[model samples]
Target: MNKYLELALLFAFVLAETVGMWRIFSKCGRKGWLAAIPMLRRYQMGLCAGRDAEGRQLALLESGVAVGIFSCIFFKTGSVSYMVAAFLLLLLIIPYTIFSIRVYFGLCDAFGRNRFWVVPWVLCDWLCALIWGFGSDFKTAEGYPFDDEDAAPEVSGIEADLTAPGLSINITRRTAMSLFKRKVLLRDIHLIIPMGHMVLLLGGSGSGKTTFLNAVTGYEKANAVITLGDSNVYKEYNSMKYDIGFVPQQDLVRGSDTVYRTLSDAASLRLPADMKSDKRRERINEVLDTFGLTPVKSSLVDKLSGGQRKRLSIAMEYISDPTLFILDEPDSGLDGVMARALFEKLRVIANSGKIVIVITHTPDRVADLFDDVVVIAKDAKRTGRLAYYGSVYDARIFFGKKSMEEILMSVNRREEGGEGRADEFVRKYSALAAGGEV
Candidate 1:
C-alpha cells in the first residue's frame, strides 16, 4: 500500500473517531466540545460510560504509556539507569493495559453493549464509537446486591410496636391533555417507609415532590398503589384516611383562637362523635404535649413564635392519633435555629413510631436530621423523575457529594444546558428495582 494512502486513511479514521465521540458526549448529557480535547476526551469518554472510576483508569493508562515512551527514548543513550526505569515503566504498563481492558468491558456492560465490541473499540475504534454513540442508550449500570450478612444489627432502644404498618407507595403519572402519551413522573416507586424513620423528600422546583406527597395523601389522582399493613389504600382509603395526616406548608391554625382551642376545634371536626368530651380534650392535650406546645397551649395562635406556629400546624394533624404524617416544608419561613428545632421535633415524632415524610426546599443544614431521603430530578423531557432513593449516607456516596445541597448543585450544573440525565437515573433505578438489587 502507498504511504500517502495509509496517511489519508489514518486521517479519515481520526476524523470519524472525533465525530463519533462528539455525538456520544452530547448523548451522555455532557458538553460535546469536550470530545475535541486531547486528554479531556478520554475523561469525557469515561464519564459517558457511567462511572468516574473508568475515566480515572483511562487517564492513568495514558500517563503510564507517556512515561514509558519517554523512558524508552532515554534508554537509547545506553544508560543503565534509563534501562531500569524503562523496565519498571514496562511493568506498570502491563497491569495498566490489563486494567484498561477490564474497564473497557465494564463500560460496555454499563452501556448495554456487547463485550466483543471491545475489538472494534481497540482496532477500528471509530466504528465502535459510532455504534455506541448512535445505538446505545446512556443509562447507569445495574447495582450489585447488598450483602446483609455482613451488615451490622440495629441497636437502637426505641422499638416500634406499630399500630399502623409501614406504607408502600407506587405511582405512574401522565398529563390530562395527553392521556394516550404517558410521560411517567414517578415509575415503580417502591419504598418501605417504616414506622420510625423521618423521610426527607427532595427535588428541585417542578420536580414533582409536592405532587408525590399529594398523591400519597390521596389528594392527587394517578395510577397508584398504596398499602398499609394488610389494607390496600385504593380499596380502604375511607378507613385508612384516619391513620394518615397531612400538614400543609401554610399555617392553618385560627389566628384568633388559642393553641388549645385550635386543637380542640380540630379534634371536634376529625375525631369520632362517639368519643366523650373529656376523651377529646385528653387527646388534644396529648397532641399538644407530644409537639412540646404545652407551655404555649394558652397563647393565641397569632402570638406564637414561628417555630411554635409550625408545630401547631403539625399538632392539628395529630388530633386523631394518626399513625403516618406527611409534612410539606415544615421549616419554611423560619430561621436556621428554628428550622433545626422543627426538624428535631419531627425526629422525635418519627421516633414515637409514626412514619413521617417531610418535604423541604432548604435542607442543607438539616439534611442530617432525616433518617432517610427520596431524591428526584427533572428528565430531558422536563418531567420529574426519581434520581436516588435510599439512606442519606448512601445518597451522599451515590452522588459523590458531601451534602444534599452540593448534590443539588452538581445536578443543576449538569443540567445547566438542559441536558439533564435524570431519565438515565430513573431507568437505572428501575432496572435495579426490577432485579431486586437496590
Candidate 2:
C-alpha cells in the first residue's frame, strides 16, 4: 500500500478510537480533555468506578497485553491470523461501542459500562487492541447539551399533564416544624401544582423549598397537613408516601452493584413475584431510554458521572409507576437547559394522570408548563398555612413582582421574623439588663 493509504488507515483507526472514547467520556459526565490521553483516561475511569479500581486495572492490563500480542501475531503470520485478531478486537470493541451509545446517547452520560462488569471490558479491549492492531481511529468522550424530550422515550407510558390547570401543592409551616426540632425552617406553604405542569420552587439559603417537599412527602413529620388532589396528604401520610415517588437531593443508590443488577434487584424486592424478567426489562428500557442509560446499562453504579448519576437517580423512582412524583431541587446545580429538560421530564410524568412536583429556587422560563400555582409565606407558621393556590399560568397575576424563589425567601424571612419576634424580644430584654447592646 502507498504511504498515504497507510496514513489514512491509521487515521481512521484513531478516529474510531476517538469516537469510542468520546462516547465513554460523554456518558461519564466528565471533561473531554481526559479522553485524549489513553493511560490517563484509564485511571480517570477508575476514579469514576469507585470500588472497582483493581478489577478495572486488571481488565486494562490484560486487554493491553492482548492487543500487543495480537499486533505481534499480525507481524509474524502475515496470513489469516489477522481475522482472528480482528474478532478478538471486536470482543473488546463491541462493548466500547455499546458503552459509547448507551452512556452518551441513552443515559445521556458516559458512565455506562457495556458488559457484565468493567473488569471484563477492560480485559477484552486490551486483548483486542494487542492482537488486531487494526489501528481503527475509534474514539470516546463526547457530550450533548442535556435533553429530556429529545432523549429516547423510556416510558411513552408516562404522559405530561397538559390538560386544564388544576394542579396545586400546599406545603405548610407547622409542616416545616414537623421536619426538625428547635424551630421550624420555613412555615407551611402550599403549591397548586396543576395536573401536568413543571413548577420550580425558588429560594435562597434557608428559604425552605426542600423542607416543604419533605413535609409534602412525609419524609419529615409536620404539625399540619400537605395537600394534593385537594385532600390533606398529611392526614393520609402512609398512603401518600406511596403516591409521591421522591428523588432526594443526595445519591440514594447503594454502591457495589452494576446499574442493571441494582435496578433488577430493586425490581425483584419491590416488584410483584409474578413479574417476568423480559417484561420488567421492557419497563427498565423505557426508563433507561428516557434517561439515556441504555449505553452504560451494564456499567457499575459507582462509575456514573454527576449528571449521569443524577439522571439514574431520577430513573430509579419512576419504575413503580407513581401517581404524583416529587423531585426536590432537581435543578440545583444544573444549567438552564438541563433544568428545562428536567421540567419536561416531569411534565411527561404528570401527563399520565399522576402529578409531578418539582421544588426549586426559581420557576422562570417554564411558566407555560404549570397547571396551577401555590405560594407559601417565609414563616414556617405562615408559609405552611397553604397560602395562594391557583392556576400556574395565572401565577403572574397572583404573585406579582416576586419570583418563585423570592416568594419563598420572603416567607422564610417572615417565619424567622415571627420566631424572632416571639423570642428575640426576651433576648433583648436580657441583654439590656446585663448592660449589653440591645
Candidate 3:
C-alpha cells in the first residue's frame, strides 16, 4: 500500500514481463532483443502468435497512444485540458484493447494453450509470459497452423498457351511488403482464357481479385508471364495498354462535360496519337453507338441517370476498342434490370470476339451471360490461389454449389459462415491442372 512498495512492484512486473517476452521471442525464432523495444515488442509478439495483420495494426495503435500520452504530459502546463486528454486516451484504448486481446488469443493458440489462458494474459500478462516463457512444460507446438512454409501448392497447373489468341496470365507469385516483412498477395495463378469468352472473376473480400486484374492489365506487374493476343503485357505495356479496356467501378467523367465531349476527350487519349481527327471522331461515334450513348451524346454527364453514367464510363474506355475488356463492378449501384442490360452489352462485346472479364457482387443475377468463371480463394496464409477456372456449369459441379454466390460461400473461410475449403479446392484444382482427375 506504500508508494515505494507500489513502485517496487511495478518495476518487478515490468522486468518479469520483459524477460518472459524475450524468451518467448527466442522460442518463436525471433531475436530476443525485439522484446525490449516498445512498439516492436508488440509487433513481434503478434508474429509469434501468427496474427501478423493484427500485430502490425496493434503496433501502430500503440505508437499513436504513446505519442498522445507524451504530448499530454508535455503540454500539461499549456491550455491542453486533462479531460480532453482522458477522452482521447479512452477512444484509442477501446480499439487497442480489442486488438491486443486478439493478439493475446493468438499467442495462446501458438503456445498450445486454451482460450482460458487469455484471461491471465490480459489481467496479469507479466506472470503469464514468465510461465509460458520459462516453464519446462511450455513450448511452441509443432505443426503450427499459421506456418506458411508449405502455404502454396506445388501444382503449377496447365502451362500457359502463349500461341493461343487470348489473355494468358501465369503469375508465379505477387508479393508486397507488410511491416518490414514480405507478404504474398497471390501465388501460382496460371490460366489461359481463350478469345471471345466472357469470364467472371469471382472472389470474396481480400482474395486479391483487384490485384490479379492489375497484374493482367500490366498496371502492377507481378513475377510472371502475361500474354495478350501474342503480345507480352509486361514487356509491351505501351502498345498493349490500348488493347486492354478497363472500366473501373467509379465514373471519372466531369459533370460539366457532355457525353459527346467526354467520349471525344477519351478518344484523344485512348486512340492512336497518329490518328487523324476525322478518323478519331468516327471511332468515337462507333463507341457511342456501341454503349447506347448516341441518344444522350449532347446530355451533360451530371444530368445522366445512374445507368447512363455507367454506360458513358464504359464508352470512354471502349473508345480504345480494346481486344481484352475488363470491368470492376461495372453494374455497381445499378438496379437488376439495368445490371442485366449492362451485362448484355458485355456479352455483345464478347460475341464480337473480345475477351471479357468481369467482377460483380451479384454474379448470379446475370450468370447465364458469362461463358467461363475464374474463382480465386485465399489459402490459410491469406494468399490468393486459383480455386477453379472453367465453364459456369462445371464450376457448379466442381464446388458442388448451385449458384455463383454459393460457390463463393463454399471457398470462404468458416468464420465467414461458409465452408472453409479454400485449401481443399486449391489442391483439387492443382491436381486437375496436372492432368489428374479431381
Candidate 4:
C-alpha cells in the first residue's frame, strides 16, 4: 500500500472514532469536546460505562506508555535501551489491555449490547466507536450507575449531650470533584465520643474511614462541626491543634536519632513554646516512662525492635498529652502478642480521660479494649454513611453478628461476598436515630 494512502486511511479512522466518541459523550451528559483529548476521553468513556476506577488506571497507563514510546524514539542516545523499552512496554501493555477490555465491556453493558461487541472493539475500536457513536439505535440503556443523585436523604442519629465534656463531630457532607463532577465522599455523620473512651473506626475499602478521621481532626476540613472540649477544631485550629494528636499508620521517626532525642524534638514542637526548657525535658521523660521507652531512650531508633519503635511513635504523639488522640493502625506489622500489648497501652491512655480513636484492621484481637465501634459503609450512591455507632455489644446485636469482622461482612456489598445490606442498614439506623432508639 502507498504510504500516503495508508496515512489518509489512518486519518479517516481517527476522525470517525473521535466523532463517534463525541456523540457518545454527549449522550451521557458529558461535554462532547472531551473526546478530543486523549487521556480525558478515556476517563470520560470509562465514566459513561460505570468503570471510572479502571478508566483512571487506564488513563495513567496510557500516558506512561506514550511517554515511554516517545522517549525511546527521540531519546535513543540516552541510557534507555530499546530492549529495555520493549520489555517495559510489554509490562504496561498487559494491564492496559485488561483495563481497556473492562472499559469496553462496561460500555457494552451501558449500551445494552452483547459481550460479543468487545471483539470488534478490540480489533477495530475506531469503527466500533463510529458505529456506537452515530447509530441512532445505540442509546444509553440505563442511567450511569455512579451518576450523582438529586439529593441525599437526611441522616439522624443519637446526639450526645452538648453540655458533656467529649469530642463531638457533626459532618454535613464532605465532597470532592471528579471529572468535573461533584462527588460526596461522606455525608450526615454525627456522633459524640465521651472522654476516656477508646472507639474503633471500622469500614471497608473506599468507605471513607480515613476521610471521617481527617474531618474529626480538622486536617481536611469539611462542612462539619467538630469540637474537642469546647475548642472548635476548624475555627480555632491553631490553638486546638495542640489538643489533638494524630499518629499515622507509618511511623515518621528518624533512624539516626535516639529515642530520647526523638521525644525531645517532639516535645519542642508539640508542647507550647513559652514553657521552660527544663519543663519540656521533664515532660519528655514522663512520656518516655509512660510508654516504657525509658529503657531504650539512649538507643537509636534504627536499633529498636518493632514493638519499641511502635511505642516510640505513640510516645512522640503522647508528648502533647492531647485530650483527643487518633491513631491509624497503631499496631500494624506487629505480632498478635505485641498488638495486644499495644492495645493495652492505648486502653490505659483512654482510662486517663482522653478520647482515643483508632483504626485497626485486626480489631477483634483487642475488642475488649474498645468502648465503642463506629461503622461506616458506602450507600447505593457510594457515599460513606454511618451504619452504626454504639457500644461493641450493641453493635453485635444490631447487626446480628457475633464478631466485628462478621459485622463488617454483613454491611459490605454482595459482590464483595457479603450480604450487600449497606443501604438497608443505613436506612434502618437512620430510622432508629430519628426515633431516639439508639
Best by TM-score: 3
Q: Give per-residue CA lDDT, model 2, range 1-438, as digits (tens).
A: 554575566556655554554555444456646655655554444433332233244346535545744463444345467666666666666654544322222221223324343343344543333222232332222433221112111111212132325433332334222211234454423234555554445444454556666766767756544556655566777666655688888768976778877666656654556888899988888888888788988998889876677777787887767666878766667788877876787777777777776666557656567765545333212222233445654444443434554444443443244222212222332333235765
* Candidate 3 regions with alpha-carbon error over 4 angstroms: 1-15, 22-40, 48-50, 57-128, 131-158
For each of the candidates, the C-alpha root-mean-square deviation to the true structure, in angstroms, is 19.3, 22.2, 5.1, 6.0
- Comparing 1 with 4 on lDDT, the higher-scoring candidate is 4
Q: After superposition, how far is residue 215 of candidate 1 from its true place, in Å?
A: 1.0
TM-score of each: 0.58, 0.48, 0.80, 0.78
Candidate 4, residue 10: CA error in Å?
10
Candidates ranked, most accurate by lDDT first: 3, 4, 1, 2
Candidate 2, after superposition: displacement of residue 145 in Å?
51
Off by over 4 Å in 2: 1-194, 224-240, 380-387, 402-438
Q: On residues 1-438, what C-alpha lDDT tens digit does candidate 3 reach at each position? A: 554575577678878988999999988889999888878888999999988888888988888777666555545444647557766877897888889899998988888888898888888989988998899888887776454433446455566777777888899889998775798899989899999999999999889999999989999989989998879999999889999999997987799999999899888888889999889988988888888889999999999999999999998888888999999999899999999999999999999999999999899999999999999998888889999999999999988889999999988877778687888899888888888978
Tell me the lDDT of candidate 1.
0.71
Greater lDDT among 1 and 3 belongs to 3
Instruction: Return whichever of 1 and 2 wins on TM-score.
Output: 1
Q: List residue ranges in candidate 4 displaced over 4 A.
A: 1-44, 53-102, 109-119, 122-126, 133-164, 436-438
Deviating ranges (above 4 Å) for candidate 1:
1-165, 178-185, 412-419, 435-438
Stretch of 10 with least lDDT, candidate 1: 145-154
Residues 204-306, model 4: lDDT tens digits: 8788999999989898989888888878889999888888899988988999999999899889898998999988888988889888889889999999998
Q: Show the colliding residue pairs in model 4.
A: none
